[model samples]
Target: MSSDESQQRRGSYVPIDFTPEVSKQCLKQVEFYFSEFNFPYDKFLRMTAEKNDGWVPIGTIATFNRMKKFRPVEKVVEALRTSKILAVSEDGENVKRIEPLDLEGTKNARHERNKRTVAVMNFPHENVTNMTELQEKMEEFFGKLAQINQVRLRRERGRKFNGTVIVEFKDLPECEKFLKTYSGEDAETLSFEGRKLDVFTKKQFDLQREATRGKNFSGSGQKARSFTGHRKNMPQQEQKDENKEEQKEETSKEEETKVEDKD
Candidate 1:
């Protein structure tokens, strides 16, 4: 192309020609989006893992004591439809459904959350206290997170919040997800009711490791060095005496060898 044509193309907007194969591929791609998803699909809806981003070890998810059961998207959606909780499209390219929070009184269900735990803070003083009310409020605010397992919210030791929350999850992944999505200074921040929250994460660490880790010793400072640069620390006469002793031992060993040869 000429420089003029190239210049014209550089700043121009071009659209792809929609060939029949391209059109079919586009339709297939859109269908795939509705059919696939990652972890934490609802038990009430049907799910399919026909195409998935990753996998969990077979027993890793099931062996847990309190995790919500997961199923293929196909099964989950079918159940949801039977219960009037799911909606979809004729071409299978769209989905709509009511989450657990949209259901009446699900916030108070007794299902367990994750084994891991994370804390959150900066809730408004109203409807929060160190009690069940605070737990309910937190459960209501976090939506599906509150429903999948047990959500434990404990009130902090100050009057700043009616519900300063210490959130506990059933596993580390859940705790991590909660922290990543909600905690931080960024705004249009996540909120509860109408009030925005200052979110905080409660981290867990083991601090009671033994003094020697697993070894066997107890002392304040480190022991002496194995290698040194200088012999300047030695008394000159003492060093000579030690060297003489070593030489004497070598001479005696040589004499013994000579005597053995004679024998």
Candidate 2:
């Protein structure tokens, strides 16, 4: 093979995926540094590649070294220095901020503090007419539960006084333990707005959404109303029967009018 062809064959290589252009740029900067300092090209390439994350290509180093022959070594060094490839200080003492943590005697601090909490029982049957009544009931119910922390009452628009009370606990673990012990059992029976209080956790409330999927409907099943399975165009059986009855009534009235005219 010809020398040029052999060199081309040797240079033909796979491209590195990570910041290939940056690697080439860095290699060029390193070549400039070595030429300015009169260091060996082979040693510089090896050291630079080894210090980097193993993604620098051999062809890049060779090309950078070849370019240094035409480029002024001083100008190359100045460009390399400005390019941020080489350290400004050899000892790297100026870059002492990049050091491992000295967590030998450090204590891990808690992100959250624990406190007493109350679980407000939701009663669907209660005729809660207003916020005042709802808040009163919550206060009364939470008073009965032991280790009651703080209760905040909240109401949503269009909802008739039915809302949630957020209870903060001294610790999350305490609240979790309380939920575990009294989750399924009746903790306290309190009468609020003429309804019985039902205690539950926030976790249980979230789980209920998955449990009742596809079962909820818009109207009662007694009437032919638009709901889960029925489409708007496809009227229910009851609606069809109602329409037929109305048509029969209209036809009878028309026949009666015709007989009266004939008589």
Candidate 3:
């Protein structure tokens, strides 16, 4: 195989060619970075935009962790030049969404989004290290199943991929259809990259998580109860000491009451 193919298989971010297709992909990536689905959650981007009237320097964007593969500011700037929803600075030094962020619209949209989201697990996490590549792969794989709004890779400590993802479909019907096709009885047969996958609706995922948490909490409570039981079973000498202390405290109170009455 050629070096380019080797690099592609390795999930290398380096662009092999600046073809129109690559440029189109770049446009989508850059647009999504500024999209409502991603913008609100990207703290650094939001803060940088806030400082410059929603205009983020293209160079700065090129330095973003996820944008590493879209490297060389010039390529990103060139790709975004033809974007309809994004505005490229006259000098091409910066980029910004043409339409102002609609916070209220995003808030309203999230409710419906949650209803159409599903959690998937058992991904071949070790095979792909770059989150962007994994996300794209997930989008392509599930794209064949339904119309997806987005695929979010779930991460664990140190920003590592945790072999799970949440896919949000465009609508409830498509979401339900995908779940019916891949989950429950068919889950064992469902595989991604040769690894069996488990799929659950957002509600089902939440309930499972809550149930797991309850079990953990119950275990801790049992340990606490056992500790109390151990204290109750303390030696006779220790019990006598505690009883004596209580009696002395009651006697002191009684004497104080008598003194107050005498006064």
Which candidate achieves the best TM-score against the true structure? 3
The local distance difference test score of model 2 is 0.37
Q: What lDDT tens digits, residue by residue, belong to model 2 across residues 133-159? A: 444455555556545434444333333
| Whole-model lDDT values for every prediction | 0.34, 0.37, 0.65
**Model 3: how far residue 54 lies from native, Å:** 0.6
Q: Looking at model 1, report the run of 10 residues with the lowest lDDT sum.
A: 218-227
Looking at model 3, the pairs that clash are: none
2 against 3, candidate with superior lDDT: 3
The best candidate by lDDT is: 3
Per residue, candidate 1 scores C-alpha lDDT tens digits across 122-159 of 45555433343454455566656543233433222332
Give per-residue lDDT, candidate 3, residue 153. 70
How badly does each model clash, as a count of residue pairs? Answer: 25, 9, 0
